[model samples]
Target: MRKVLNVIALLLLIMVPLLTACGGTSTDSGTSSPGNDSGTDSSGSDSGTKKHKIGILAPAVTHGWVAAVAYNAEARAKELSNDIDYQIQTSSNAEEMTSQLDDLMTWGAEAIVAFPQWEGMEVPIQKALDAGIKVVNFDIVIDAKGVYRVSGDNEDMGIQGAKYIVDKIGKEGNVVMLEVPTSGSVSELRKKGFVDTMKEIAPDMKIETYATKFTREDGLKDFADILTSTPKIDAVYSMDDETSIGVLQAIDEAGRTDIKVVTGGGGMQEYFKMMPENENIWIESALYSPAMVKDAVDVALKLLNGESVEEVKVIPTTIVDRDNYKDFLDDNSPY
Candidate 1:
């Protein structure tokens, strides 16, 4: 009887070890256990917490404003790193941008913030919309349907430029208007605002429109030629800060004393520095900041999270001149 009892006890010990091993395996299947080396429950912490994937499409750094657009976009992305995963692509032209768009789509991007400055992007952008990927446009306007846009008040910049010029140089003066034709809607809206406002307030104001690109090199070269042909100019309406910088240099080099006021757009630091230095010329800039791209990124995220957003969000323009230029100055600003 004693031998049989000892045998039963030995059997119970062996079965206890096997049962304990089976229990551990069952625990791993249900929750965290020694076999579950991942240190998470069977119901993962990341089950419903997948990060949103966002893609940014911008123009390559052709200008300081363009560079700042990319810079601000990256800054905003970093700020929201935990909430999102992002990819930014810059291109010189439409074809390159289209290829980048395809890459982003292939990567399973949930939303794309596009700055399609070049033409022929409408078809590709529309395709992205059809695929159910949200697109948010920055600055330059395109004809893509259902795409959100975030931009400074471009037309108001022209209106403010007109108002500033009229106030400083008076209603009667020869104004050389530098218009950037390649900018498409941006130029048209700004020109329309300036022209319409000028006609309404100062119909007698003699305005001459000329084509120029948005570069200091173009501004200097074009304005130098404009100075030679057109005499007795009172004010110059320049649609960009870089262009105005060139225009200012041409005026200084030519020793022209007739020009009293110069209006500019886009918040540029170097251009703002010139405002206080040149006491004679009322160097004014209507603030169309590259920082506005941050808002575009925000719009993209908002749409991804199923939040309501406006089709177009136009940020109001802030007119900065010699008096207020110092207030708007940022040493960290790339543009």
Candidate 2:
């Protein structure tokens, strides 16, 4: 009887651990299911379906080009279907930008597509990376490794702009440069290419640089000051179309016929319209179209679908003048 009681006790002890082990395994299996992971159901449609959440941070639409970028991003996000969800946030400055990014991370963003409006956003971006979020820097680039970047060939655009200006002004003349902020990578590369090419091709030409913001009003004010400071401005190379508009206004108001050419980047409608008719002044522009949002979205989708993309994807840019204006001009184009 004693042996039988000991055997019964041993059986009970063995069954207790087995039951406990089964219970723990059940709990873990429940937690580890596919649907319970955060941001894995970004579509927010049917329950139990896997999904992805993508966040986008862009600059506020202070200008036409930025506005176009914002519009395209929103439209493309919606068109991507129910498997992916996107949250877009716009910021006008650095403080607001950081706060917005924090909110997105809290909401369980699996990936981020950011166009850092200014410099010094590296810290917040690095934080996102530490949290295991995949980041894609669109249009603008920040100095962060392992982050994908999609942008136009800014240096090439500048080289094209310089070539156009040199061709119009001949070997030797006084050329005025309307410059944007140095903090932006696009602006820096474009300016460098332009300056270097000018030195290479038109060694005799004197180049004057004037600092201006990426706005029509700033362009006008800065160019007005340039007109007052410099007497013999033979040609003007505006960095952007908005700046070119202001430069054109300044030149028209000052009646500066000595300015033979006004060249710009970006395919603005106003510039396209002016290129065909403005024969005397030789109006030409490098085409830095604001269609990169579509490309970014496409790449993001490919990534989500388990495909690989290049770390840095550069969209091709072209020069648009009167001779080839028709090829680039789209009547229904947003930019």
Candidate 3:
């Protein structure tokens, strides 16, 4: 009986060792496996990777330049898809833009890039800053605190325009300064730069200041009247490319050969073509490309990445004329 019991006990020990090795009905249901040692959650996704959220706010496309600002900003956002998720909102007025700002804030956007053209944006933009959202201003300047700005040198555009006009038409020529009051500080800064520079360089240069919108229609109608009134105008310090295009047309219709130069701003493809085609007049535009909005987008990303950036970034103005218009031409450009 004792020998039989010993054999049974030996068999039981061997069977138990084999069952334990095969993991018999012993499942680790609540514990993690070796494959999931990297701390993956129940959904099998790692929690360490997180993308930044960026918001872009621009005005409704009223002009080619405005359209390009939106286009370039979206293009850049797509290019950084791996690193960020973005939302772009286009508003027609300050009130609409304020609403859009609220929407972006609700969306939990880490940073916002704003291209505000209208007034009354200060209060709402300040509200955004108070919410701990980083705001990046593009093109148009606003009165909001803690906002970073990225724009072309507006005042330097005026300085370059004055220099170009004086160089082409001489120091003592008559210049028609077309100012767009609707453009606010853009017109103000450009005008200030031109006037200040002209005063320092060509004090005797007769400047006829007039207000006009930044449109071909306004340029044609307003310049036609100015051409009729001022018979001996040597140049026109037009503040926009669209305005300059119309001014050229008005000059052609009126058959004015007295005007020697037409200065413009905002780099337009059509205007660049006009520079080479018009041989008689020195057609010049201080190159303020709307693509600068891309820089504003970049600044927003930099801020979100905890990178140090300037409070204000101003892209230097490039003077384009018949001599170098081809170099500035972009067939894909909307403006």
TM-scores of all predicted structures:
0.87, 0.83, 0.85
Q: Model 3, 142-253: lDDT tens per residue?
A: 8888999999999999999999998987799889999998887899999999999999999999999999988899999999999888879999999999999999999999
Give the winner by TM-score: 1 or 2: 1
Instruction: Write model 2 residue lDDT over 151-210, tens digit each, in one string.
Output: 888899888888888777788999888778744887888899999998899988898887
Our tally of clashes for model 2 stands at 1
Q: What is candidate 3's local distance difference test score?
A: 0.89
Clashing pairs in 2: 40-51
Residue-level lDDT tens digits of model 1 in 143-216: 88888999999889889999999999889989999999888888999999999999999999999999998899
lDDT of each: 0.89, 0.79, 0.89
Query: What is the RMSD of candidate 2?
Result: 10.0
Off by over 4 Å in 3: 1-48
Per-residue lDDT, model 3, residue 306, is: 92
Which is the winner by lDDT between candidate 2 and candidate 3?
3
lDDT at position 296, candidate 1: 94
